[model samples]
Target: MPTPIKLSSRNDYESFLEKFDTFLLDCDGVLWHGNTLLPGVREVLALLRQKGKRLIFVTNNSAKSRASYSLKFKKLNIEVNENEIFCSAYIAAYYLKNILKFPKEKKIYVIGESGITEELDLEGIRSCGSSEDDDGKDFDFNDIHPDPTVGAVLCGLDTRINYKKIAKAFNYLYSNPDCLFLLTNDDSTIPYNGTLYPGTGSLVAPLIKSLNRNPDAVMGKPNKPMMDCITNEFQLDVERTCMIGDRLNTDIQFGINGKLKTLLVLTGISKEHDILIKNAPIVPDYYLPSLGDFSELCK
Candidate 1:
């Protein structure tokens, strides 16, 4: 019912910050591109902290765990705690362990990175398929087999993804129809070091197509589980929280799904015109060229 507001005026910008005490931010594009921090964005974060606002980093990236994310924050000279960071890998493990009560005896067949493995370990769940599984040899039909003990197949981005990995996942899902199919996120691509690389979704597409089975849960932006992890822990009020990110499909949709206010930043996947299109799937409560723009208000 309400219209989207672009915060270009001084009064609008200040008012936007004042309206919410909690800020949920996306990592890759809104805060930094790859390892490089966006200009003036750090100052904006410091300003938010000075205002005593709650800051949570929500990312679809399942490549790293909380500790890894914290290490990155430390590297960037950004102040963020492990508890304040929420990633799809962490949430997937949490959901399976806490909510689903996944059996301890069974193992999760992981088609992901170290992040998923680490998170599952913290949750006391065993898993198979790590870098060690990449033997680099072509998978033979006679040699391929799925572990009967695999209760779930967890998918995420694998930089070294190859046909062998897909074959293993496909066999696992095909053989064990009851096994839960979970995805860390459906982010089609990730921009890094000035190049767009195929993301987790792209890596998992082959399996999805061959198996003809959709993931039972996608644990990332726009998905309820990721937000639930933070909301349940912090007791945050959706009415007073703001979800900020560059992509409308995930970040903005996550806000809308949770009934929280949304802020769209133009530094990442989506642009100004994307949100203005006719019959747009999602529209944020506010928009800005980048979070860096708010650095002016920090002064």
Candidate 2:
């Protein structure tokens, strides 16, 4: 039962800052809640920049593309480069394009929002079944004429998920064993504006149940695919990098599994009690009340 050191004092902040040359930060809970900026986040980020620390925003939110996320940063008046963000949507696209080398003649059936499709477009990959397919039309077994050209089914956080989309996606996988199944992420719940809502994992439950199969790859936090992509892209030295987030399952576990330093912040899905529980399955190397704690150092 190893206890996590609480980062509170200025000395603690100094030591922590000096320990890592790169910081991988989770967006929703650690930096902001929905559109609202968390307390002292800007100051802390500025301080890190001043110290010449490399910052990377890593998020499992597949509902937005990197360009869309960049807009959110601008809305908050935060100066962030598009390259500094690595999102699940982008990872999925990258996987299809570079790793998977998806056939040019084939198309992807997207069970998600524009985020997934937008990234796919950037990769010069064709896709369908996103916002355009989310019409209020009821599902009809007869309407499902499975497209053999649909080489893959990519699932993400689809707020507009309906029976039609699910039925179509299921049919694609069922009819074509070769049709690859991919998930942008599997976060069960997402923190938004201080409330927990069903995430991408929840959306894919029906598909998983009906298909009786897991995705071939889940390109998000705590997954090796996403981590490998990041490592290759940045050439990161895992030992000198720290992962900071508010969730134990995805964020902290991502860091721990990758052999990187993990820092848990008590501002999102995971609370202090989670780590304090007896025989906790996962724990971070350090815990802090918030990323904003560095505000004092910034002062």
Candidate 3:
């Protein structure tokens, strides 16, 4: 087992600066909590950009479109482009259209926001069952009419998750053996606006239990689809690329799964001591109090 290396001293930080050329970062916890930007995150990003580092923002949140996410960055006075941002929604769409070769005529039953539908639309993919109609309705469990046109069922964070959606998704997966069932990200919990809430996993749990079938794919951190998307798009040297995130299971494990070095930050979900405990789920290569601590190297 590889123990985490704490970069405490100036020499340690400087040595790390020479080591990595690219960075993969998580957006919610590692960069900011909800909409508020963490202290020195801007500086750290600016410094890394100035130092010619390739920075990629990888997030599992399937709520916001890349354009909207970029607007949030612009609102915070951070320089960003749509290309640098990678979200689960985009990858889910990509995986379905490209990897799975899902037919264009077939529609997806989506239990998510427009962030997902927008990406699917970009690929000429159609979707139905958004919160507008599918969510919050009562399910009688008897005359459940599953949409035969729905060739796939995709789940993400639906704030209004209810019986109707579950019944439909469950029936689609249970009845249609050829129907693809996927999740943008199965994060059991998520941090948003400085609070924890049940994530996509929780919303999809009922359907999973009722259908008794696992999703064909989970397009998020700690998974191969996300790694495949990035590695295929960019030429990243596995040893030189580092993934920095706040969560242990999703983010740190994501790096480990990709065979890239990892860095855990304490500013979000995981505590400093969480990684030090024996038999940790996934230990990072290096850690600091926060990503902003890397600003020290800018000097």
Model 3 stretches astray by more than 4 angstroms: 134-143
Candidate 3 per-residue lDDT, tens place, 142-193, comes to 7578667899999989886777777778888888898898999999988866
Candidate 1 similarity to native, TM-score? 0.97
Error of 3 at 57 (Å): 0.6
Local error of candidate 2 at residue 154 (angstroms): 0.2
Task: Estimate candidate 1's alpha-carbon lDDT, on a 0 to 1 scale.
Answer: 0.89
lDDT of 2 by residue, 1-299 (tens): 58888888999999999999999999999999878798999999989998999999999999899999999999998889998999999999999998999999999999888888999999999999998777887667898887999999999998898888988999999999999999999999877766788999988999889989998999999998788888878978888999999989999999998999999999889999999889988989999999999999977
Candidate 3's error at 294, in angstroms? 1.6
The TM-score ranking, best first, is 2, 1, 3
Best by the TM-score measure? 2
Q: What is the C-alpha lDDT of each candidate?
A: 0.89, 0.92, 0.87
Per-model TM against the reference: 0.97, 0.98, 0.95
Which rank order by lDDT, best down to worst?
Answer: 2, 1, 3
Segments in model 1 whose C-alpha atoms lie over 4 Å from true places? none
